[model samples]
Target chain A: MDSRKKEGQMKTNDILEKKSTRRSFMKKLSIAAAAGSAGLVTGGCVGGSGSTEEMGLKWEEYFKKNYRMMTDKEKDETVARLEKLAKLQDDANIQMSNQEPREKVLFGYAFNISRCKGYMDCVEACVQENNLDRNSKTQYIRIFEMDSGQQDPTSGDGKYHHEVPVENKYYMGIQCFHCENAPCIKACPTKATWREPDGIVVVDYDWCIGCRYCMAACPFWGRRFNWGEPEVPKEELNPKQHYLGNRKRMKGVMEKCTFCVQRTRQGKLPACAEACPTGSRVFGNLLDPDSEIRYVLKHKKVFRFKEELGTDPKFWYFMD
Target chain B: MKKIFLRSGLFCLCFVPGAVFLAGLPAMASGGGVMERIHHAEEPYDSMAIETAYQQPVKTVRAKESWQGGTFRVLTRKDSITRFRCSVCHTDKKVLVKDGALFTHDDIVMNHGKGENGLVCIQCHDEDNRDFLSDSSGKKIDFDHSYQLCGQCHFRQKRDWLGGAHGKRDAYWAGERVVRNCTSCHSPHSPAFKTKMPETYSLPLDQ
Candidate 1:
């Protein structure tokens, strides 16, 4: 862990060096442009009287290094900038977390197929907790209502609107599995997505180049791309945010479930698990032999979704 | 010769279960059931075997039932109950709702058991002592620990709940292993869940 952090610092220094060189070049260009367009500059200065601070913050954010490559100081600065931006735009005070994953803790999930009654309480909780885009209806978790004979979740219907737990049917939820050998990481051209030490696969949203390659490469259909500006109502916004998990995203970037890193990193259950009315979901440290997840894995007749794909997903499904 | 024989015996004893344990792991990872083998290789069922390992401190109430072995903490129940202290109205006598004498529990419809001869209020509730519930043998049980009454017939769910597979747990995963009691999700009178519309449904194209 120490060596990995050191490597991150070294990479950050390299990026900082490059950023300074780029900054000088941009500065020269801006100076030349300003000199060339003196009349326009005076008009812009007059027109943008109270917006210089916001522009400066945006400029710094554009030049910020990737989350994984940032030093402690840089991380703090970025978080503060985001908080300031939130206050400026929405007038909503939000606390964004950059809490690192805990040691010796590999988070895993277990879903009891028989128990889920298809009420979709978890879907509601996840959308609210993550401050998902309201207009587009971006949801991290999808509960599929599977027929009695069919075991495959993909074959089931996720758009069922009528009264749920329809006779002769069961429900199974699917989300980002946070696979051990995540193909999305390999597909990323910019190294935006990577698995943390504690087994959570997270995307550094700023670094994602809107390529959508990770989305294509993911077998589980786990990644979601922002085609337009993601919007959340001011009152419904989840003020507690995480850099890699649930922080607001701009247009053209990709986002997925991060197991509620903002909450889970603080030892809380993911919002979906906590909101499950039927007690179908279980989340815990896989490393802990005595965890409820471990107990389920040990005793229950369990199977991973798409185990044949060799993704080695941390999520499992079991029947009572 | 004696020492060699003892070493061989010890190795055989250790290696047999160790081999079985290692074999069970891949089966678990691959999503296969080798439960019969696991039972043979490990110690007998102990409900309290799992230990709590959390970074943050958690608030929990100790379960009072012997089936739980007091291994885990359950979330506090009494505070959440809307009409606690059943003895408030029935002081020392059976208080029956005659006609329309301002009934407090008029909306409670008992749909728990099957058929016309299904579970009645007196079967689970003590008429003489409204403060407590009665089990099959008519043992007085506090309302807070109502699982003891529910578990009498639904032993399978009780077992799964004890093993952490059937019931809902507290918000935090790491902290003191606190779990919700049976009554938290299920109404004691009508345990079965009613069908309801989903809170939010995503676009079909998004899937």
Candidate 2:
């Protein structure tokens, strides 16, 4: 009875402390805001930022909440700011939409080990489709050529440029696996990274502090860090972009494949899958048991690169 | 970092849409029905979004292959090279044309079906009808459905192809699934994928 009484008192005391702090914050907010604004105004009058409106916008942008936490009004304001800035900087009028995940539509991928010829057609297609940084040599998809009787990824070389379909050799391609237990998301100190409803791990480029911790966490070497200012030529930029995806990424941020969120969410096959001449890559909805991915899993001897690690990757590979 | 990611997004949005609109201007201005091509570009997205019968992919058909006397060329469905129809030369008499001395198909070069595999032209091609292909059972098959002719001996590959385990699917991931014909990717004669250079965006090394 004494212990329960003590616990109840402690709970009430904790509530009281929270309430007192909140009350104090409310009480001092307007006064402090007014003082700060007045000080800025006076300073501006005596030679400060020529336009207070620009100053206010900068403040609003800096203080905006996380992408997932923002209210509808906040989202609109932020979008407008982005549009105005894009226009001012690049003279481009782009539409970056936030597409919600479709209901019962979890994405998965599969690749035929026997079919891939290391043609690298998928890599070229991905770069063209995603508007990757041309100057940074940013390539999302890499086709690795393996020797005779070898299926291990570590032994494969993506940089091989010789005439392909080498005798007794095979090829396989790698990209973001979109694991169910994403280590990259967990490694982020800020809440800048998260998995979407469709299980695509995404980073809020705007919110990221560029700490590079997430890069260290990924075992698949999935995420790429922007070490230099990305320089995509004006003519090469793809205008169709999703806010969380292939939108023009900023310097010092991290980015990975979202399974072509802008295209796939609208029901188009990802560029890599579409460009494959040999049809090595197979993609479909995991929720739908009738999907081709499920068929490959059930009928073929499918294996993943890192199954023993317990990441539960949605991507699978099989050879006939 | 006290940095600005939105400011960058703003920059991106500004330039990207403007760039797209500029590209669209040329596309819109082109004469002689450029609209159809533009429509075709958007077809994958539109067709994929259409609510239709989710046909579980894969369909089985028997396959067959025939010998041609010339170079390995994937026999196409158009059959544009055919000069004369079956009725043009073939008639009531069971006669060999030109006394069986290199009278027709002078370009054909048979590299496959050697020794025990040595096959006569009529083995798969209909003896009486030039247009119709024949199976081992002497089943008269349409030239348009020649995949059935190739399936006669390659029954295992045919099974794999029909199960969506061995072939390519169409670009549109959902909706109607259209698979490529065997001859589209493979030469009917050689039946082996040719080695080629990998497509490169930019080489990392000069070598």
Candidate 3:
């Protein structure tokens, strides 16, 4: 009878040991999952949970101030954080423009409204060029076709589709005018929106406090604010990047047309101008009287948008 | 002495009317005629404006000296008046017999009447519609000879022409192909190209 009791006791002990082993395995798995999620959030392998306020403190601080006032160390840290956030959103490789002083490179664009055919080729090109987040709202250029004999540019319709050479319609493509005297720049108390020396107006994604003052100030209605994390696929991301232009902006920042400064600064034309079949969008030195813009102004009866307003817009239009 | 007095009286009568016309005043047609009919419909000042605006310059060719080799052309006042009249191109004196005949052209004539009765060059070739060119040899060339010259007045049509969206060309895909001039579809004198549509020639699809 003692021998029988001893055997039963041995079986019970085996069952208990197996149960203990299963519990330990489950605990390890839970810990590993928690560690992975924390890594994704912090970009570090160390596992821990932090409150939203604690996690976003650095980003919030960076966003609160102007980029011009940021120290060299702060700027580097901000850029690094942005890069990490971009990578976390998409595993795709990102190449950021290493241009220093980042403020001096100004870019500008002038489109000939007379030549635009409402082809939407530039719209498609921008989507591919910037690797826009497909799920969210993003549009680089909005072309509106006004009725014949109508002087008001705002009187046109936006949706159009068909073959080339659509008649009796005057197409006005509205994008970032990158004005020399941008009201948005003046309105931004934080100086988030500033003009570069090359004539491109840009927004510091990290420095923008989401005040939306720039959006209100823009006369052309060119600014777009990201409401959520931009969801872009990794493969389609453009590795060629620029600091002031399309380097994959973050959530809650205001963005607008930069005249494709990244490409223009590198001696290349804007992607929209390149994709245009009719060569409507003319990009060149406004300072150079010998440029195509100069020829257009000299030969054609060029008119600007709201000329009475004296915005001194670089964009010019003439009858074809 | 009697003959000289009569000539002087006639000269005075003509001079007074001519002076009035030059001073931005419409010349009163003798016996209340067609000029009066048209003038009555328009404002008096506007009629004068139109008459003054329509005044033409005379053409004169001066004989050149032996050293100069070529004669220089200058316009005289009487010649300018004649050039301004419809008789400049339609030299047939009978055609300009009626005073109102100078203003008639194919597009302007309201009534067709009988065959070719309404056709006139002045009808279509108004100040806004006139487009002409002079060749190197001093020959007046029509729109057919130079399409671009015709485009100056017709800005919208010219744009289509340059973009290859209007006018007929030799091929579809190949860009390097001969294209027809404006005169192929339009006559400068008539300027009503649409009138020749369908009846004169059908498009390729219609054919």
Candidate 4:
């Protein structure tokens, strides 16, 4: 009781100490009015550059809160606006998703180095599934052709044009490993890139400032930057898209693999894993002890690409 | 608190209508024919989210042995084979001649175990039953349970496959754990992948 009375007294005293006079309040109001009017004049001038609908949408998009901070209604509105804009620009019917991560699911991937014969079917499937820009040659998966005795992946040639599974040559596939302690997230000046609750790292293209800090910070060169406007052939564009995964990205923003969020969130394998003919790529929830990934981790002689860096990449590699 | 509430009520009364009016003005001014607002009906979030994708009419068989205290299911092999029901032809009780001529299965290369002490067809196939495969002990095995025959020699791979470490699973990661059988990928005649050019290679540095 005594402490409550003292708290009340302190609050009253604090209010009394910082009380504003009518004159000062009026002065502050006048200053605010002046600033608001100046802003209105400049805003009107900028609004003249576009159609009325475009201006309205641009203003709403500019003022919309960050994806994490947005309410469900706000996310809906953002999706509506983006979809409408896509229709206006390309005359393409695209569905942009705002799927929340599922519960009790942390995705993990396993690749068999012995089984992967550098087929590159996965790279082709990734291109079609993600609607990646064709002119830019944006490939998410790279199959490195390494000598059988080599320990490092980067020492191999990824550009071999001849027949695959050459004598004394083995294949190692690499993509965004979606590290647990993601350095790219830390390097983003804006919190544009973040790891999802399901352990898939994603980037908000709209929020990225194109600073390329995340790219520079990534150890594996996992991130890709758009130098100019990204172009996908109209007929080749994937109609199904996730706002964070394969949605149409503009110039300057960065994109990386989200483990095919559009499909994976709906309980399907990533396109690369599905397209692999040799049954090499295995994907499943890491939390499930009975999952294929867990089985591989337990029974096989598995190793991560870079275990010493402490990135704790979800991707693992094993030989038969 | 009363004053604050009254003030907020007054502010809402003054501003909400104005905001609503501004929001609706664009639709009216542009007329109805300009842009059709695409309605995205909100769907209830599904926890498993696998029902739509689990489309296969899978015929699963329980594994004879559990992998890790948990029994799993494997897709059956007989349904998808092109020329199944081998009893349609080999019905007669006759000892099959060692093949030097091509007759029914000319397409099959019979290249498996081609090195030392090469395997013959009758080693795996039961001449008496015609439809069933047999282990070295001549135990009759159904076509669906061909893994038992394969496991006699390749036991390590069979164990890995049973444990979900070595085979392709169904499209879903969260539903009934259905995996493909060994014969689904590997031909019983030959099981090695031949050398071939990669489908696509866009090496940025090389270009």
lDDT of each: 0.78, 0.67, 0.53, 0.78
Where does model 4 exceed 4 Å of error?
A1-55, B1-53, B57-67, B93-103, B202-207
Q: After superposition, how far is residue B157 of candidate 4 from its true place, in Å?
A: 0.5
Colliding pairs, model 1: B54-B174
Better of 3 and 4 by TM-score: 4
Question: What DockQ does each prediction reach against the true complex?
Answer: 0.23, 0.13, 0.01, 0.20
lDDT of 3 by residue, A135-200 (tens): 663776777766778766566666544443356767677777776556787688655777554456
Of candidates 4 and 3, the better by DockQ: 4
Candidate 2 segments exceeding 4 Å error = A1-64, A71-88, A93-95, B1-132, B140-144, B201-207
For each of the candidates, give the backbone clash count: 1, 26, 12, 0
Model 3, native contacts kept: 0.00
**What is the TM-score of candidate 4?**
0.78
Model 3, residue A214: distance off in Å is 1.7
Q: Which RMSD values do the candidates have, in order?
A: 10.3, 17.6, 31.3, 16.6
Writing each residue's lDDT as its tens digit, candidate 3 over B133-195 gives 443344454433344345555767655444333443221111112333455444444444221
Interface RMSD (Å), every candidate:
7.6, 17.2, 32.7, 15.3
Best by DockQ: 1
Docking class of 1: acceptable
Model 4 residue A134 lDDT score: 89
Q: Least accurate stretch of 10 residues (summed lDDT) in model 1 chain A?
A: A1-10
- Model 1 DockQ reads 0.23
Off by over 4 Å in 3: A1-65, A70-89, A100-108, B1-207
